[model samples]
Target: MKYLLLLLPVFLFAKFASNESCKSCHPIIYEEFQKARHSHASLFKDPIHKAAWLISPDYKKKKYTCAKCHTPTDEKLLASFDYKQTIMPDINSTAQKDGVACAYCHRIKSIENNETQNINIISKKEHVYFGNLKDTIKNPFHKTANNKRFQNGNVCIGCHSHYRNKYGTNICSTNEHNELDSANCVSCHMPKVAGTPSNMKKRKQHAYHGFAGIHNDITMLSRYISVEILRGIDRFFIAINNLSPHALTLHPMRVMQLQVSVIRDKNVTNFKSKNFVRILGVDNNMTTPWKAKEIVKNTSIKGNEKRVSTYMYKLKKGDIVNIRIGYYLLSKKVAKSLGLQNNKKVNRFILLKQKVFIIKPNSFAPLQQ
Candidate 1:
């Protein structure tokens, strides 16, 4: 039996193709993927990964732990470093530069379990590719196998779900899988388009390769949250509902802030701010990239959670109030410390819903101004 197994065709041992090879058959997907965050997963370009590598006290001695997700294809570079130094892979290599390349994802045979960081990918060097569709067709490039996990969203659980640090503490908690019933990652991230997956197949709805996420657009945020403002005699109430199945600001470094500002006579008066921050690190330092000790201040709304905060201010007639919301990938202080250019402004923040309530001696009503 062992001798017979060795007699298999040489294509069984064929090396996996590069992203370029995948482009020949999947040009549309390749183009969209280039715009995705996954394509820019290189350590040199990713600010978070660079900052972590620069600040980690154990980076020089231990293996960089980030490689398991960022650049899994650079196995040769990973082995060159000490087993402890597993996080940082060789960023100098071509395969590493591709980030999560096309071959890396399609070649995955199976995921052993759903543990976020402990995803066990069964890979083979052969030309066999796996997909959600079951209709096997003869293709010139490679063979295809059906994987139901791809359809159910379990395939993405390993990377998108909660993950623990070396200290056995939850560092990255993204429970998107548990939030929606029967909804898969592809539904939102890779929206379906009326087209075939490959040129060799008939026209059918296929998932887009954009892989939309936090970096995509504000429209995505609006889909998961709703905001309303209620006015009282001396205080204003801001109500936020987390319509998402997953926690708001799932990543440790990500933050969402709700701010209330008062304007009088076309000038700003009082400003109050509340932060929904995910705290991580050894000493509850929000700047720490990974190995979170605990959640220091998690004011963020959980799955299907609703929160209302009241701000009190002495309001006179003709007073205009502006309520705004901002979302950030990292605090300005942390971003400055890391010398990142993208952190100066609240780029991701958008005005969800704002209202101006005029206070009269006897009554208060919302005004257009």
Candidate 2:
């Protein structure tokens, strides 16, 4: 009977209200959230996540480990539902479809510990909303409270920093929170916009709810990385500085490459290429996704980390060296495996920076005819 009970299906009772309920009172915030990636973070809309979950046997077996960040709810409430037998709340209910909705985030009272995943969420009945502002006005829906952690980047660590696999291996470790000694995640991603959070309130500068990141525009990518080239005898030194508070590519699945080309007489020749990747896999082969055993090669630029790449070449007086850097959302192999060849989210290599440097004749060397 005990063995049979282990396989018994669990039913979940809805403990939290949906985003639709909050939309009536806070229409402006709801609309802003609608435009953000958080609204589409569910498995239904996010192709990459859907693909990863679909391909994983553990997900199909009702392990539900991915649900924490993807469709986070009270874990105690989630324990009642059999993920394999029942549909995910996001897919089944309209209110839950608003992924990472207002109620879900507002319910977070505090973080119990310094650990990235140690989130302390209050039950829905508490009707408490936490924010960085101490002088928030009273709301009919929920009590407003001040949470200093919300003002900094630490709040984002629970979902953004890291996630481990069942084998005690970190499948993804963004390390964005701890990487920078200065600015927090909100400072960059959620810049202050001049507007009232609610329609009833007076206009004031508040953190925008779009929560823009890698999934959005490439503007952040361009702003954070600065490239400088130094000319030397028979070689070129390229320096890439990470100006952002986090790693250049926060997502472990993403890849960035620096390409150098030699241009002469209108003909372009590939000179050298350096790849920055966060390697993770189950075995030494280091090819598996989500089953990462260890990080093998993490060439990613950490917060404020300066990386210098050197290329040795025999240069002519007229040769023009071109340097270009690009960010790819996914490696070609990973995309192909996930069948994301034509997917809209699977973007092509976004060229972030490009510069051309002309090689001048050295005082000791004769000019080529």
Best by lDDT: 2
Among all windows of ten consecutive residues in candidate 1, which has the lowest summed lDDT?
A: 7-16
lDDT of 1 by residue, 250-366 (tens): 776666788777787888865657888767656656546455566666777787787888877666667766666657776666566566647544235644444455555544453
What lDDT does candidate 1 reach at residue 30?
79
Give the Cα-based TM-score of candidate 2 against the true structure: 0.79
lDDT of 2 by residue, 118-150 (tens): 455554555777777656677777777656566
Give the C-alpha miss distance for residue 328 in model 1, angstroms.
Answer: 1.7
Alpha-carbon lDDT of model 2: 0.67
Q: Cα miss at 336, model 2 (Å)?
A: 2.1
Give the range where candidate 2 is weakest over 10 consecutive residues by summed lDDT.
360-369
Mark the regions of model 2 whose C-alpha exceeds 4 Å error after superposition: 1-14, 21-29, 74-77, 81-90, 113-117, 123-126, 176-183, 261-272, 313-324, 351-369
How accurate locally, in lDDT, is each candidate? 0.65, 0.67
- Candidates' TM-scores? 0.77, 0.79
Error at 62, model 1, angstroms: 6.5
In candidate 1, which residue ranges exceed 4 Å CA deviation?
A: 1-15, 79-92, 113-116, 133-137, 176-183, 194-196, 200-205, 260-270, 282-292, 313-324, 341-369
